[model samples]
Target: MQKELNLCWNFGCFYSWSKTLGCNLTMQVQRLESGDFDLRNRQLQFSTFQIINVVRRESIEIGYWTAKQGIFRNLNQDVSAHTYLHPMPDLNPVVWPGQTHIVPKGWQIPTNGKKLQVGVRTSGYPEFMKVERDPVTNAITATGYALDVFEEAIKKLPYAVPYEYVSFDTLGVNYGSYNDFVYQVPLGVYDAAIGDITIRHNRTSYADFTLPYTESGIAMIVPVKDNTNKNTWIFLKPLTGDLWFASIAFLIYTGIVIWLLERRIRNAELTGSFFHQLGTAISFSFFADRERVDGILARLVVAVWVFVLLIITSSYTANLSSMLTVQKLQPTETDVHELLKRGEHVGNGGSSSYVRELLEQLGFERSKIRAYTNPDDFADALDKGSKNGGIAAAIHEVPYIKLFLAKHCKGYTMVGPIYKSEGFGFAFPKRSPLVDDFSRAILKITEADAIIQIEKKWIGDEHACKNDETIISPSSLNFKSFSGLFLVTGVASTSALLITLVMFLYKNKHKMGINIGHDHVQRGHGTELETERIQESTADSNILHRMIQMTTPASKR
Candidate 1:
């Protein structure tokens, strides 16, 4: 009977354990409760009440259910009586050696012995049974079994499980001064994760970032004017000293050469004294006067030398003056405020930052600051003068102003210095995620040398000088023009040199009388023929006759 009771208790414990572990164990209990036993013309009802009572006493009591009172009582009494009559000695509760009662396989009971172990041999055993105690909190935690299983299961989850939550308050305390301070939020800060919150410029840093959002550099504010007509004097200032020195040297050299030539000519004419003049006049009177060849040659030589010197000096001075004039016209200033303070009306583009900085920071009156949409219109306004018909100063980027000045306006000049000194970049909305990505893309392009190549393709570096204050030389503009002039000059000089060389060679050949070519000479006639015949007869005579004729001296004859 005790053994039978133990079996019923084990069944009940397994049923309860399986239910807790998310397994179905109720069917087996129901079968046992409903099974009919036929014996000796007497019917006995097997009630589940006796089994449940035994389970509750030996194991942890989960809960109880009250059935129809008489049914369970009558069933329990019948089972007790039957067990007593059979008195099965082997039915005594078979407890493990150290345990007071048998526990279901694969389960662990606490050391207090208040509960029964169930499902001891099942796969859920060690996992569900393990427990750990926290030293800090003295809290008992289920460290093994289902807890471990849960951890492993979590690892296999498709998404990250948020194991921890961070709070910004833990990082630092908020100070009162930050309440009213103007915050400059980086456009990137709005998209970045700050403890899982996105913030704008004015938003609190609670789970929000304080990253710097602005790209900062130096900003110069200058007046907007027609900077195209750069003053020629400003450009020439640096080269004035050199030009002056060259001009002085040329004048002095030219004066000296002219004086020397004049003196030489005078002295040569004076060299022929009255006696020589009288002799020349008497000879001219007696016979057609021979041309004064020597005097004429000397005069021609002096005249050619003086003419060459004067031509060289005049050409040098003209070229030097042109160069100096060009050097004097470079753009020097683009500042608007300074121009306005000096009583000059300044013009600016309506949308340019130059206008804003001038009025706001520079304290210029709005009426004094004239804004224009079209640059040409602005230039016209400046040319016609302000509303009062007075000359207005225009300011703009050196390059743009220079181009305008070169093409359209000539009266206006760029004044003061350039205000801003940085390259322009495309502006975008702040806190955009695209900022970092685009910046990186720009960097990549720069690294690949694409930016320089693009610049060369469009606004070439040759035009970069337009942004500077230097005046562009006309020669630089029309390369072919300069080249053509140079070619013409070279050809003319070459022809002149070749002609002079030929003339010199002819003169030297005549003076030296060198026989350069072979030609036959004709014999003379008349008396010349008679003389030639006599000479020939004498030559034919004997050597003693010719010697006797040569020995007959004039004194002896």
Candidate 2:
């Protein structure tokens, strides 16, 4: 039986046994153990052999062991000689005869049959191994195999497998379980799951994760001021006191001057004692002086005063009208408590945090809150108010409010402090794979002081108002503030005009050549000269009468 079993063994069993025993078991067993077993068993057999005469019969069946030995011998010689042959008929009845099996000609399989053998020698079976090459590019195409096959292939290799063998679907399942799968999955079915196991979404039970490149916040949107209300009183309030004082002072001074001039002209006696007159007397005489001064000063004062008063009244009236109109026309509730109480119809910009604070977290009615595309629209609606039938209030950043007031010249005033302050940041989907990388880059930027540098590039520090604040020295202020300086300048100008008039009078005095105090003439160098001239004139009259008598002969002698 042992001999028969040994002879029945094929090349596979022979090779396996030889390898396991570390020697050729077939030769050793057949030579030593086979001979000893036969010799030891021959003496114990006692049986009679009977021969019966009968017709000679051809044997239909060959010994199973003998046929198996023939097949094994043929398979062994075929393998050793590298010759292709059909499978043994006796060994496997199902195998088809004369069927040719093809295998890689030049390659050899590993002795250990490891998939990734570095160096080995054996027949390379095509069913277990394959090599593919691109016909056009002549490049090795991807090798397709199972994970175990790949592991085995690299088992005897000098280095471990360089690539990770992960099933994206498996990973995806694990990740989905971990994160609760909040992420919108990309299109396509995965053979294996893939993802970082650490990420998870607690609230939604989703596996949404951020890429290393993702950031935490939205991009900073710069606040812009609409110029619709640019010239409004809200913007002018900073200088309101100065403008009001200047306007009122001008009107008062002009009115007073008109009153004083009228008073001076109307009362002739009062003009001489202008400084001594009673205030009441001066005031009463101003209008009464009209008749005495031919009504010129009175009419002029009345007209001037009327014009100035109109100007002052008109300016004040316009301001009051604007305030009242704005207050009445505003669609939103004007009072803060009213607005808070009527909290419906809140509007904010899309990216504003005020919306988050007021409408979302504060439990305000979100349906009533509308988000504006631009802050300008929000401000416009707010300024329009409930008169136009709009939202109650617009909550926005203080800086934006200031900017709007500055640019639009609108009269809308900021009524409250900053609701909250938040640092601006960039935002992305949490499932983005780039989150870590982006975070690292952000860290690096902070470490390198690049964030500060970038901030400086976009926005500088708050500017100082050098000209807005009074920087004048005390001496300069004193000079500018001196009331006497204006009075002196006026007096000096008046005195110069008076002096010019006096000089002009002196120059023109010769044209009339009159001295009021002098009579016709004194006609004297001395008393003697006067007596002589008188005697001479008397003698000349006597001589003139004789000459006239002598010459009168022609007509009237």
Candidate 3:
């Protein structure tokens, strides 16, 4: 460790005491007059003293090997302070004759300042960078994601840094004047340009950038799909063709099953001619009246069928309600590609170089594209449509598109896959000390979820626009949805009929003249009543014996 020697070198140099590592308490006091000092490869000059750590005390200029060269390479999944700047480990140390080389920071640092001139733009990008001026006060007010990020970063600094945001004439309220802010930073017109300045190759060549505060991407704002196409068969949407046919079949099958079982018993509800029996069967299933069903089999079948019908009807009603209430919105154009294919005019902020590149790639000619400055122009363009000098879709970044959506709730929406981007970052002169400091502060802010809070403050909540369904989707039912219901009714009706038939055949076997011989009956005059009673008693005994046999254990048998 080098200790600070209290030798006055210049009028700016002051007397200060500092200790070096690995020294006994050997007291030595020395004072000297002003002299020229050199730190060029002299190892033995300051061997006895330690230079005080000025990094924390002053706005030290930190020399940096440009991290942006391969900053994005081998990027870790984690978005944290430590991983924010991918240090160039392969960087060889550089030496300047008078400049003190800051090792470990991996670059040399010289003298710097505490004051900053922050360059600002007049883009008025709603939530990201809203630059406004008061009419009466004429005071310029700056607020947005960019401003919040800049302010939050400053708050995390160990030492206070005073900065004033100055609006640049270079970026004078143009629709897409992003390059203007970046160009001014390298010219010393501003210490840093702090707005939604994307870290691109051309900009970084002349300047340095902090870890991006916001995600960078290109997106678009398009008109919400028109839902005015009235569906004539909307009622039929609750159930598909297969389900409807299956439902009708089940109802008829249930009616027929009830009629078959009840008609044999001479039941008033079921014992009728073919047409009458059909009507009764249909009524019993639809109205599901169990009171008229005389036999246990008919009642049980009707009960299960009715339960199944209840479930089916309930589901249909609920689905139908959802289908009707939710507005199925389809976009006027799916994306820029779709627009290009159809040769439809797209609206965009003409000043954007990024957008121009993207539009040209999508095959949209400059003449086919319309430039819109404000909400009124965009609204008019969208209303007119592509056929009548109108725009099929609007193009902008996600942040700007989000602001537009918030302002116009139902009229417009964002669509298409977000193009890959580097995200938004603060711009600084090449190798400025603020880069590392800003990265650190940003990490702290992100870790604390301050970014989210700031975004909510400016953009409001996204849930406000979620009330309407913003897509085109037809609502329809499928047989799979009602499979369980059909299964229940089918099984119950079949089981009841089988059980009833078994009981009936068993009870009437003697009367039907089966499994009985005339030699087993004693012939007698005026014994018909007695014979009938005997037959019934025998039938009851047989039923009891069969039931007992069924319930008896196999082991015991």
Candidate 4:
């Protein structure tokens, strides 16, 4: 053994034999590895004496040396009392020169090796943290997605974090809000908190949050109503407003083109009274058997227009039939704007004022906002409606909403914009070393589908009502859906009009005294005007006269 001891002679030093050596030197000392023992700054507790000896072994075991419950003397011979107990295994380096001998940083050193005091939120948000007490033994059990995740993360940690859940909700104790519950961590009320606590900027100011484990959004939940009985305008409901207007306008345009192409032909059905002629012009397609078209251009326009009409009518019939047969379920309230404009009351899940503040910021009156503590309250408020002293809708975090929907899957649904948020995370004291370790553990579990298993255990039926077709309403057919059809029909009508005009002008070229040669491009406008006048005098001249007038020079008109 190397007996050369590096002792501070100025402060004085004393040596005593080990306990087995029968020296009676009752000192609180544990075997320490070979290292520089800085006794100058260390708060020494020397109730007994310890021999400084270095024995060479096959391998060197290096670790921290902590003193607990002992007495020491300085250069002035003044005795100062301190207790340095290494309650936990040290894996990192840190020097504590104060009253308490703490373990190294990044690791926990509980006094007397006590378990960690992890505060699980009580009574408020059960979707993340749920606590139940047994009546026989009064034992508290914490369970939920958050608790599962926390336990899984703890298992992944390098060191075992011995912890017991302490619920904030107790007899005669006002649990307060989530913010207040989180604040208790800094006050040493809890070593950490695990729940559906959102990672917001304000909360992070006093506490550190782990990475979010759930979707980050606040959504609105509203009841759905069936519209199968309300079918006064069901025919119009098959097509959107723009589509209806476009269909009517194109039908009229096609009718006018057909009339123009056949009017100058002097067909018996075309020559009639003002209203009779108008009926023939527009309703000729319906009277296909009775009416006859003398112009090939008019026949082409009729065929294409009939095809377009066939597709449109078939689509409208199918849509209307489906609407009549199926249940048209729609939300009682579609969005918050509608609720706010109607002066309807809205509810928020839980007792926290965070969602209330958000609603107020969105311009909802203070009196119009109500807070529901649980899913039952939410259901009751929604059932009552604002007019009957109930809320029109309730807003809550997506996870809670999902759980609520799972229970009340029949008549309710989540709707409107999802207000973005930082989702749910575990909270710890600001800059707590355990935060990093827990964060890394969380990453491990999330990466290996462990989180998914835990979520299925807690919120597996989140999308249980997704396949209920009664809650979804089919969308109406819009103009864009048939824009190509309109384009085809419009092009066909215009082409036919052009072709018929060419035919009429060619058939009467000699009577109009117009040449078809390239040199005829310089023909005077008087010639076209006289030709139109002679045609009008002979025939009714509805479309042919207008065609000549449009082709004539602007100055001549």
Largest lDDT belongs to which candidate? 4
Misplaced by over 4 Å in model 2 are 1-338, 347-357, 360-557
TM-score of 1: 0.28
lDDT of 1 by residue, 163-206 (tens): 21111122243321121111212222111221101123334432
The alpha-carbon root-mean-square deviation between model 4 and the true structure, to one decimal in Å, is 17.9
- Candidate 3 yields a Cα-based lDDT of 0.67
So what's the TM-score on candidate 2?
Answer: 0.23
For each candidate in turn, the TM-score is 0.28, 0.23, 0.59, 0.68
Per-candidate Cα RMSD to the true structure, in Å, reads 27.4, 28.0, 19.1, 17.9
The predicted structure with the larger lDDT, 1 or 4, is 4
Best by TM-score: 4
How many residue-pair clashes does candidate 2 contain?
Answer: 61
User: For candidate 4, lDDT tens digit of each residue in 1-557?
Assistant: 11233321111222332222232222232333343343546654322333222212121122223244332322233224433232223322222212223422223334334688888766465666788878898777998788889888887787556688888776335767788888888888888988878788899999998888777788899988877846687789999999999999998898888888778776777776866776787786544542487677777777888888899899999988887888766787777887888898998965656778888999999999888888888999899888899999998878788778877888888884458887888899888878888888888887888977887777664555563756356678999999999999899999988887887788898656645554476566668888999987778666778789889998888
Better of 2 and 4 by TM-score: 4
> What is each predicted model's overall lDDT from 0 to 1?
0.37, 0.36, 0.67, 0.71
Stretches of candidate 1 above 4 Å error?
1-338, 350-355, 358-366, 372-384, 387-417, 426-440, 444-557
lDDT tens per residue, model 3, 1-557: 22233321111122221232111112122212135343767642321111122322332212121122212222232323333243344322222122334321211222232357787765545556767666797666787788988998887776456577777653454543678668788988888898877668788899998887765677767776657446898778789999999999988888888887887788776655798888887788767655777777888888888888888889899988777776677666665676688788887765456766778887889988777766567777887888887888888766666666667777776775457667678998898887998899987887787977887787767776652766557567789878988988999888877887888788898666743555446445338878889999999999999999999999997
